[model samples]
Target: MQYPEHLAHFASLFKKRDIAHFMSAPWLVSSFREPVWRYNFGFKNDQNLDWRVHLCDGSLLTDPQHVKLLNSLQCWLIASTENAAGPGFTNSWAAQSASFRRTLTVIDHILQSAEALELVEHGLSALTYDVMCDIIEQIGTSSYVAVSTYDWNNRLTDYCKSLLQTTSPESIDKCLEEYPTLADITPLQLEENELEIPLELISRVRAALYINKMYHSNPNGGLNVNSIRVSALLYKDTLAGKKRLKPLHSILGFIWRRDRFIREFDGVPVTNGNPDRMTRRDLVLYRTAFTFLQKISALDFKLPSKEDLREIATFKVTGTAMGRFKNVPTPIIFKAIKDGIELHFEHGPQLLKSYLNIAKYSLKHMVNITGIPDETTISLLEPSIAELGVQYLGISTRSSGRDPGTELKESKEIYFSKLRGNAGLLELIGVYYGAIQLLVGATMAKRGSELRDLDPTNCLSEDKSWLIARIAKSSRGQKGRRARNARPIDPLAAEMVQTLIDFQKDLIEIGFIDQHLPLFSSPGIIGTSSLTSCDVYLYYKNIDLFCDYFEVERDSLGRRYYIRQHQLRRFFALVFLHCGYGASAGILQWMFGHTDPAHIWNYITEELPGKELRNTLSQALSERIATGGATHYTDVIDLIESKFGTRNVSVMDAEKLAEYFDFLMETDQMTMEPVFLESDTGLRVDILVVVRKQDEMG
Candidate 1:
């Protein structure tokens, strides 16, 4: 075979390596006489030619053939490296397979042609430092070192300088024109600013400069900013720009339209002298403002200092200035009375009297639970105006009223009725409220509630006894039906259901209800009550309850009764079919349920008699035959002696003998022949009589 041009070139280069050439020249000449060595010349040992080894060692040559080939190739490689030849630089072991080396070498020669090099240089420059690094790494260390020697002498300074100064001003101008908008420029500048610029505007400008530089250098494609770290920093700095460069118009917009209803009334008191007469409207607004402030305090922002707010006249006063609104907002003040009523109802009539006294005493003294002025409280109550001679607390009510006092008095009546309607209502409310309070308290206390006790069902009233009774009854009924239908009882399925029920109860107790439980309550054919007869049987065909029972029994002797359930069902079907208890159609449906008759026939024919019974029958038959027992005495003695064993002496023996005789007679004649008597003088001899005497002696 003719060697490719590049391969021939490689061979020449290898021959130039001082040590390799000196060692391989004699081997290459000798290889011509050895077919193995000749064949190895084109064989690739390291197909990928990964450039990791500093020297190709003889140890890598698995056979003498590889050794001879590598030796010749190594000499050629060294020569090419020394000469800086095209074949040396362009040849890749990956492309030069033993089967295709000639083609690959031709390709390499073509690629290194003067015409090809000139074409490549028209629009592209020499490789960069990074690209050179990649090449050096790809070539083995020995080749890399050889190439490096040449590179050090030639140097790549001119290539580096050319690339650095390659950008065109026209390209930069074109990029600037394309991205002239502030949105684009500002965002780009912001990204660059994150790396080095501290001033937001300057950083954005720097990013813009970098982008413009890349755009000018690569005019055909946009900037390729692929670094994740750089991208994250860019995003972060852009967000900072948002905070710093917020438009003046936006600030003005906020100033002009921000809601100030709460601020306007902050320091002004609705309740002056009469704390009892504070209105509901003032109370509602006061509570709403307090809620808003509480929410604000929970946020991440640094709140403005009170002194700062005071310095800025534009800033509004808040709830802090009014102190606590206990007496001033009479509705909040009246919460004590409402709470007393709630407590009284919760604890029943006995505790009611005590709470009422507490309410009366507080009312008589005009004591404040929260400390805002009475005038402010009255103002808060004005909106829910009514004429019931009681203060309106701004809570919605069905009663119509125009005066504050009437609305308040009516609200008090409404609140009392709501408290009295359900005895367990307060407890229910307490359960929910206490759970929330417990969770919050736990957060504050840093001690969590037990998961088991957090269930909603645990909070159900004792009055729900009726519901429990109903569930228990339903469960019992279901179990009873399952027991009856699964006659003799499939303990395994029963146990499975029981376990599932226990788990479900546990979930329910923990306030988690699984929707799938009801579906699993009755599973397979038994669960699908609509199925009947053979249909049910076929549905449960794959379940292997009988086999499963047998396995279970085999594993544990005491669990033998587990097989009874399936066995009894089979026995019932067999007996019913044998007894002609129903019409063929009805019996078929009953025995096999709605199954195809062919399937039923197949099952019946394929099924073996129960193992225990089959064994018992086999043992009995063997013993009878061994004893020469016979039941029928009309046997031909000669036939019996010639065919089956010598006739049994006893009737049991004769019966066992006749059983074997009958079996042989029924067998295929070609496979087995039955015994026949062939006597010159035919005597009326009974096989059973002859076998009886022999059985007795034995």
Candidate 2:
């Protein structure tokens, strides 16, 4: 039989090197085991660590000691409970009165309000089957038994020697039954120069058994933090060739060496022999590294200060800094790689600064040559230092590599420049276009013909002045009294309807409407053609592509300014809040199709800055309600002096003052409160406030 040249060469190495030394002791190969996952892009160190699981099924170990080992393993795997029993003990001595009971209930409610519990439940969804098995096996085996650093290659080699001396067809057939389709796998056969035989057959069996240790033990494998920690420790111990039992000493050459197994089960490190200390220290180090990686990954693209730079330098895995993490554990090394990435990220701002300095010096020289060197004009050429560090390494500008003069001649950019100058027109046009899409979608979605049977004309009526949209579904009430059927939109979306009416009339004269007289032939587009949802996406995609037209940076994550159709609800809702049209949560909830008022709180809080916004808003509402009129800042200060005998209202900014006034209106503390003011011309003016009644007030 002939073999490939590569196979023959690989077989020669097995003949020369003892298999047990090669398979069991990875430390002999290298002091530091390379990790499975690499942080930096480079050629990897050879992966020499291989735990043979396919051979050992644990069925080989059947003794009374094994049962005791299993029990201890289970005990070690049990989770330790941290008690909050101090409150319970305190309550035991205290009175069991109604007030005391009420206080306890309130405390419990506060405890439950924490968001950490919700986040933990979310994280639990990511625990996979392989992760669970790794944990459980580590606990049960006690870094002994199946998890051996005791060289099986040596044991197999000795067996092959005896088989070679007494070579027979029957014995070979029996060996083939166990590991079929293999020859010259052992040391003796390899020593005989049988290069044509499949020598990997023995190692392949070991690999299969190792896999079985992780997942094939049970149908529904289990997982917890303890299992993960313990498994990592076992892997470390195996690689280091520490605290392994001799094969001849264990019962049936498989069960735990009774003395060492007990120590392992007692929470002693198999490698270091520290009782009551298993893999906890190693696990902590790994976890700490993981946490650092997570933090670095989540860090926003901000320019790190001097202190942040110092902290980042400690874990960096590049240049001279890589020496700091050279001999650290694999997990820690990965963490260092993450740190290096963050360091690189932070350097972006510094790189930008360097480029600017070079530009500034060049500009000064050029201007000097021109004989009109103005320091201010040269300084103006420098860009402002952005708060965010640059994510993209390459240099880019709003002109898309073209000079500003050349860009100005482009039609798209010219049109965009005009639109930017007239913001009100831009907003009104966006609102009009967005409203058409929404109304059409809503009407179609309600009728259950959104995707399949879209005929934009079906939404139109005889009168071209109005359009309707289905905002909510009709539901049965008490005594089968059904609610109103798909409410009309003459008032609900009045601004959009009116804009559509005018737009349709203009387009109708151009002969663009369908036979049914709908405003859209199919749907409305930014261009002269009809559009759909797909068209809307393509429109925004093109807008993003033409970022130079809008004078904004293009990001890999998509548009920094280009608007999607769905964002219209959030846009208009924010507009309603900022413009003092309708700021209450209920109005926002209805407009945004949110069932819970709490969901709206996050949006409102994000929109309105200041840590004391909620408190300030509440206080302002109370003051306005007490006054029963639209109170100016001057009047409010007077009221404060009368109540607290002090005036501090003058310190507040105009923006803060407006926020308070808006808060009063949104909460309906005082409805349409009127105020009389004297203008600069000494003319008396009547001002109408924007407050509307809340549901409770009504």
Best by TM-score: 2
Candidate 2 residue 106 Cα shift, in angstroms, is 19
lDDT winner: 2
**TM-score of candidate 2 on Cα atoms, chains taken together:** 0.21
Local error of candidate 2 at residue 248 (angstroms): 61
TM-score of 1: 0.13
Predicted candidate 2 versus true structure: per-residue lDDT over 490-606, tens digit per residue: 333333444444444444443333333332222311211222222222223222222222233222344233222222222332322222221343443344344243443344444
Off by over 4 Å in 2: 1-415, 420-467, 473-528, 533-629, 632-698
Model 1, span 558-659: residue lDDT tens: 321111112232332232222221123443343343335444434433332222122222223333334543234334444456665555544334324434
lDDT comparing candidate 1 with the true structure? 0.26
Report residue 462 deviation for candidate 2 (angstroms): 6.5
For model 2 the local lDDT of residue 532 reads: 25
